[model samples]
Target: MLKSLQNIFRIAELRQRILFTLMMLAVYRVGCHVPTPGVNGQVLASFFEGTQGTLLGMVSAFTGGALQRMTVFALGIMPYISASIILQLLTVVFEPVQRLSKEGEQGRKVITRWTRYGTVLLSVVQGAGIAVGLQSMNVAGDPVVPNQGIGFVILTVFTLTAGTAFIMWIGEQITERGIGNGISLIIFAGIIANMPSAIVNTIRLLRTGAMPPVTMIFILVLMVLVIMAIVFMERAQRRVPIHYAKRVVGMRNLGGQSSHLPLKINMSGVIPPIFASSIIMFPATVANFVHVEWVQKLAGMMTPSHWLYNVFFVAFIVFFCYFYTAVTFNPVDVAENVKNQGGYIPGVRPGKATSDYLDVVLSRLTFAGAIYVSVVCVLPTMLIGQLNVPFYFGGTSLLIVVGVGMDTASQIESHLISRSYEGFMRGASIKGRRG
Candidate 1:
């Protein structure tokens, strides 16, 4: 591992990319500390202290606690993410978007441009709602917003919208010039930023006898096991072997080959949980501002610990697992490409037959994936609720952290391998010590 770290810095280009990504992340963290104008920071903080189990708490976690602080980046990268999800769903139903999606690189660029526009629109709307909501919120008889008015609303909207746009730009720059995915890395950084504090709180609980030392040990062990499970599942793949017929081109064989199409056990990655959580949280987030009896009742039913909430959360995760898989992977296209390349799945006919086989395999895999995702997500809520843990330690946060860390490490390994250096894992056999 130490040698691998040294090898990363040995490659100048990879070193520069890593450094650039770190710098961009630092900028994002710094922005999370710059407070939004006209808000009472203390009062807002106090208010968030009581909202730990709510949707707002999850949003705050995603933003690295920026929402609790009402920072310039309080909205974080959520608006952009939401916009991207919206566009993805639209591509399935809207003919124009579907056409644009199929147009290749140029089409993708156009869709990305539209996604940016949607991000800006969402930021403005959500920011305005937040501003208006803050005006009515009070902690210990102190208003969250000191001077609430249309002017403050406009200012809040503009500030948050600009902040999101800046974050989007930073993510894009990192993707273009740095290592790993910029957006996922940004969220990964945010969730990880709270780790020190969580550790500290756990220690405080242990010392004060608020939490049993044995319980703490158990929690730590469970966390390690969960992380292991995540790593294993994330790396698991279903390989479908393919064979290519030999082609005789003038006296030389050119086309005979064997390969396998690797389909991930969890093709959707963390999208299903993210989409499910966002959808489940929307109603409660809106209810926080509205005081209607029925709305409040509905919101209460949708709380993270509620049965209805878990059911819906699991259902949506399952739904989106299939939905996102369909959006990203097309077995028909894969089959077509393979057929064009003179390849066929072993024991399956080419074209439609191959496509049908792939779809069936994928459906089974997706169902299992959905169950895994739901268990990972819902189990944490049960633990937190039962144990009264000081911090959010699992669910979507864990998944994203593990997934991003693995992806980034894989990219770094590729760079090292391309430079002819030993990677993180040494797979080749070594000669006997005496020899």
Candidate 2:
């Protein structure tokens, strides 16, 4: 491990990328400390500290404690993600977006441009809502904001929107010049940045008898088991065989090859849990700030302890797994591409039959994926509800962390392969002893 660490710095390009990503992440963490205008940070912190085990706490954890601090980045990248999801759904429903979605590179650029615009618009609205919500929050019955006027609201909105935009820009820069998927890496950094503090907090709880030491050990063991399970499942896939018939071209034969199309069991990646959480939490988040009786009731029904919450949460994960997988990976298109390239799944016809074959395989994979997601996410809810444990290492958090880590590692490995350099695991082979 030490040798590998040293060797990373030996590669100048990789070292530069690593440093650039770190510098960008440091900039983000600094922004998380810059308090939003017209708010008492200490009072807000006290309020969040009181609600440590709630849904808000979980969201705040993803934001690297920014929400707890009520910082400029309190909103994090959620609005952009929500806007991106909305746009994808729009592509399914709207004619123009649907057409644009199929237009190849230029079309994708157009859609990405629209996504950026939508992100800003949503950020404005969400930032404004957050501003109003903070103004209404009275910590310990003392209003955190002295004057809840237009000035405070507008300033808060501008500050937070700009913060998100800044974050977005940093992510783009990292992707262009640094390494990995920049936005995801930023989020991964945010979640990881809080690990040391979470560990200390868990220890403090043990010391105070709020949580037993055995509980802490159990949490550690559970985390390792969960990570191992995730890695295994994430890597699992069904490789469907494809064969190309030998073709004649200008007195030469071409197009005969054998390959397999890798269809992942979890084709939707970490999207299902994210979509499920946002949808389930919408009402609860609203109820946190408002006094509407029906809304409050609806929200209460979805609280982690409620039977409705667990059932619907699992159902949503399942539903979105299929939904998102369909949106992102289209069987009809894949079949068309395969046919265009003179390739066909052996024993399957090249057009409609091939599409049907893929649809069936994808459906099975998606079902298993959904079950895996449901099982992983449900365990944390059960632990929190039944055992009253503060296992902040929830399935969603683990999914995001592990998924992003795997993706980034894959990209790094590809980089190594492209440059003819040995991979990250080259010298540290698991199946053999090091020299």
Cα lDDT tens digits for candidate 1, 222-333: 7787788899999999999999999888968987899999999999988788777666665577688786899878887886767888898899999999999999999999
Q: Where does model 1 exceed 4 Å of error?
A: 421-435
Which residue pairs clash within candidate 1?
Answer: none
lDDT values of the candidates? Answer: 0.87, 0.82
- 159-180, model 2: which lDDT tens digit per residue? 9899888888888889988888
TM-score each candidate: 0.94, 0.91
Candidate 2, lDDT over the whole model: 0.82
Best by TM-score: 1
Lowest summed-lDDT stretch of 10 residues in model 1?
417-426
lDDT of 2 at 309: 82
